[model samples]
Target: MSGVDFEQVMQAALAADAGVAGIVSRRIFPLSAPKGAPLPFITYQRVSGAPEAVLDGDAPCERISIQIDAWAKTYGEAKRLAKAVRGVMAGAEFAAELDEDRDLSDEEARVCRVSMDFIVWA
Candidate 1:
């Protein structure tokens, strides 16, 4: 991951995919979305990562854990967004290989959320 723009690549991948962009429209963000932003947006962050170790040193590739949160006003929309993310990133080996996911709500905000975790060799 050294010297790589992880967030930029991730953002591009999401934004370029029609399945994701049709809903979010490049609203994908790193770490968090802006305050009071629009609904059905997305936020992603690196939960954990490690260099691919070799017998003597680090390798170019890495093992990374990425978490993506899809937020919307309806539970259905959140789930749809997760599916799109999983589809678009399947080749990237990130969002596709979902190890865990949960449907949630923000009581105060009254919004639906689907949080998913995926681990992959990036």
Candidate 2:
């Protein structure tokens, strides 16, 4: 909706859990991470969605999709961070739903990554 401020949604995401904070050290990237940044951090981006028609000057409800990813040196650490994220997003103020989670490991890079997809209605 044009009247709906998506900043509030971002704030809710940042306030999800203290455990998530501890893991990422408050590093939540809306874009890209800095060069040579350390591991065990979080990154998120808003995915594109279909356009909705607005009728009678009434703003249509917003359906926002976000992908949150956690990168760590160990699989267990990544899983823990992902779990914390899930716990917080599940109780967000908005109607947020966790769609899926994909966990990956990079043996060459010696890192584990967990990606979580979420849809929030505003």
Among these predictions, the greatest TM-score belongs to 1
- On lDDT, the candidate that comes out on top is 1
Candidate 1 lDDT (Cα, 0 to 1): 0.84
Error of 2 at 101 (Å): 1.1
Full-model lDDT for every candidate: 0.84, 0.76
Writing each residue's lDDT as its tens digit, candidate 1 over 33-109 gives: 99988989999998998989999999877777889999999999999999998877786534446778899999899
Model 2's alpha-carbon lDDT is 0.76
What's each prediction's TM-score? 0.90, 0.80
Q: Which stretches of candidate 1 lie over 4 Å from their true place?
A: 1-3, 93-96
Candidate 1 residue-wise lDDT at 6: 64
Instruction: For model 2, give the 10-residue run with minimal summed lDDT.
Output: 1-10
| Model 1 lDDT-worst window of ten | 88-97
